[model samples]
Target: MREAYLASGLTLSDLSVQVPLAKSKLSELLRGIGLYPRWEIVSRLAALLRLPHVPLYRLWRQAAFEAHKSREWVERSTDNTTALTTSPAAPPLDHRAFCELVEADYLLYAQTFLIDDTACHNAVGDTFDILWLTWNEALASPDTRSYAWTMLRRTIMSRTPHIDGRPHFTHAAFDTAALTHLTDEQARADHLTETIALFQVMGWLPPTQLDVTVLRILWRMPTERVSELMGVPPALVRSSQHHAEHFLKSALYPTDNEGRTP
Candidate 1:
C-alpha cells in the first residue's frame, strides 16, 4: 500500500483531498498507529487507488471483528458439514519466531543448493527483503506462518537456479569420469575437491536433472515434498535424480576397458 502510494508520488496532502482524512490522520494510518477506517472510507480509498477489494475487505473484517468480538473460528469436516466452535485466536508471531521459521526452512534449503556461506546468507536475506517490502502487512492476519513460508520460497526460487561457474566453467564439461569416479573410495576421501568438481559438472546439467538432485541430495527432502515444490510427479523426480546420479558417476569416474579408473 505504501509502495503504491509512493509510486503514485502522492503526498499526504494529495491523498487527503481524494479521501475524507486529514494529513496527520493519514500519516498515522500509514504508520499503523491509528484506527482503521470505516468500510465506506476503505471503499473510497480503494477506488481512489484502484486496488482490489476482496483482500482489502478481509483486512477490514479482521480489524472490525477483533475490535467488537472475541476469538473468531470456522470449522469444517471431511463430510463437508460446516462445524461451529470457538477456536482460540491465532497467536501473534514476533520477529524471533519469523527468524526461527526461516532458519528451519534454511536447514532444508541450504542442502538443496551448493552455495557458499555468503551466498546462502544472501538468499535468506533476500526473503526478509520480500517480507518487509511486500508481505509484512499480511503477517498481521491469522496465517502468518504460511505468508512467511511463501515469501521465503519465492526468494529461494528467484535465485540462480543452476550452479553458475560461467566464465570459470572450465571446458571440463567433457568427460572427467576416468579421472575420478564419484563412487571411488579414494575419490570420496577428497570430498572438498570432488564437491568443487561436482558443482562445475552440475552447471552443465539440464534444469530438471539439477533441480531433482538438489531437492533430493542437498535438501534431503522426500520425493513427495520435492514433487510438491517442483510441481512434478514423484516418479519423475526420482527418475531424473537417478539419471542425474548416473551421469554424475559416469562423468566423474570413467573406467578403461579393464573396468578400473585410469
Candidate 2:
C-alpha cells in the first residue's frame, strides 16, 4: 500500500477515500496478495486497490495457473482463432524485430506522455478522418498490406483501461514534436515508415511480406480507433500496453533487474 501510494503520487489516506475497503482491510488485502509495503506498486496496484469492481486480473491469472497445474485451458480459450476470423496464424516474432517494434512504440508514446486532456482530445479529432479513409481502403485489399493494416488497426483501436471515451486521435494529442525538423510530407512519410516498421517487427511479419502502403494507412489513424481494430479487450489492452511500454523502456534505458540504469 505504501509503495503503491508513493508510485502513484497518492497518499494512503487519498487511496482510502477512493477505494471502497477500509484502510485496515485494504492493508490486509495487499499483504495477502504478496505485496510488501516497500515494493513500488504501479498502475496495477492502483487499479486493484482503488477500484472495487476492477478485477485483479494478473493475480487471477497467476493463481489460476498455480491452481490448475497448466495454462492449457486458458490458452485454448484465448487462442486467436476463437476471437477473430481475421486473426492470422503468423510465426512468432524474432527478438530483433520485437525490439525494434518496442522501440518505435516507445517513441510514439513518448510524444504524448505530457499532453493535457484538451490537447489530447483535439489531436484525436483532427487525425481520425484521414486515418479512417486510409484504413478503409487498405482493408479492401487482400494482400500482406491488408494484413499489416489489420494488425495495426487492431493494435491501436482495441479498448484499454488506460484510455477512456471514444478511441479517437482527437481525444489524444498527436505528438508532432519529433517531426519538428522535417517537412510536412517528410514527417508524414517518416511517421508511416516508423509505425509500420514497429508493427511489422512486433507482428513478426517478414520484410518481404510487409506492405508499406498499409503502414501509410495506419499513420493517419486515431490511437483509440486503432485499439478497437486490434480486438484486444479494454482491461487486457491496458495491461498489454503497460507491458509494451515496459519492454520499450527497458530497451531504450537498459538496466539491471534491480531497476538501476546500466
Candidate 3:
C-alpha cells in the first residue's frame, strides 16, 4: 500500500483531501503502525491510487483473519460481496503477458509448498490478483519477476501449516514413492524419518538456495529457465545451487565430516 502510494506521487496533504482521512491516521495506515484500518478506508485509498478494490479487499480480509477476527465477523462485514467479486477492473495487457510467462512455474512452486491441489490453485490465483492490484509498484521495483516470486512464496508460506515453529513436512514426505509404497510398518517408519529429515533440512535453507535447489534439482528445469524465473543472473543461480548442495550435504551428514565417519 505504501509502495503504491509512493508510486502515485501523491502527497499526504493531497491524499488527506482526496481520501478525506486525517493526515495522522493516514500516516498510520501507510506505515502499518496502528490497527488494521477499516475496509472502507482501504477501499477509498486504493481507488484514489487507481488500484482495484477487489484484490485490496481480499488482502484486508486476509489481514483481518490473521488478526484473529472470526469468520462470522468477516462475513458480516461484507455488505456486497457480489460487487467486489465482479469488479470491472481488468488487468493490463502487460500483466496478462507476465502471468502467461510465469504461470506454469508459479503453479509448480506453489504445488511443491502446498501439497493440496485446490490450495495450490488458490495460492497462485491470489498471487496474480495481488500482482494485478499492485502492478504499478511492481513495475517500479528493481525486478518485477523477483517481486512477484517473493509475493508468491509469502502467500504459500502463510497458508502452509506449521509444527513446532517449522513447516510441517509429513504430507510432502508421503509424495515419495519409496516411502509411500512400503508395506512393512518398520520400513515405512524408517523411510518417513529419512524423508522428513531431508525436508526439514531443505526448509532451513536460505530462500534463494532453497528455490534454486527446488527448481534445478527437484523440478529438473534448465539453468536458464531458473535464472529467468528468479530474475537473477545465470551465474547467481549456479552459485546458489552450489551453495545449497554443500549446505544440504553438511546438514544431512554432519557425522561424516570430510568423508570420514566420526
Every model's TM-score = 0.40, 0.22, 0.78
Better of 2 and 3 by TM-score: 3
Local distance difference test scores for all models: 0.57, 0.38, 0.81
Q: Mind giving the per-residue lDDT tens digits that candidate 3 earns over 35-99? A: 76667677677777767776677778877887998888777667533332334567788999999
lDDT of 1 at 108: 52
The TM-score leader among the candidates is 3
Summing lDDT over every window of 10 consecutive residues in candidate 1, give the lowest-scoring window.
74-83
Counting clashing residue pairs in each candidate, in order, gives: 9, 21, 0
TM-score-sorted candidate list, best first: 3, 1, 2
Off by over 4 Å in 2: 1-177, 181-224
- The better candidate by TM-score, 1 or 3, is 3
State the lDDT of candidate 2 residue by residue for 63-135, as single tens digits: 4454563566545433432111222223123422432433343224322322454433323322232223233
Alpha-carbon shift of residue 76 in model 2 (angstroms) = 51
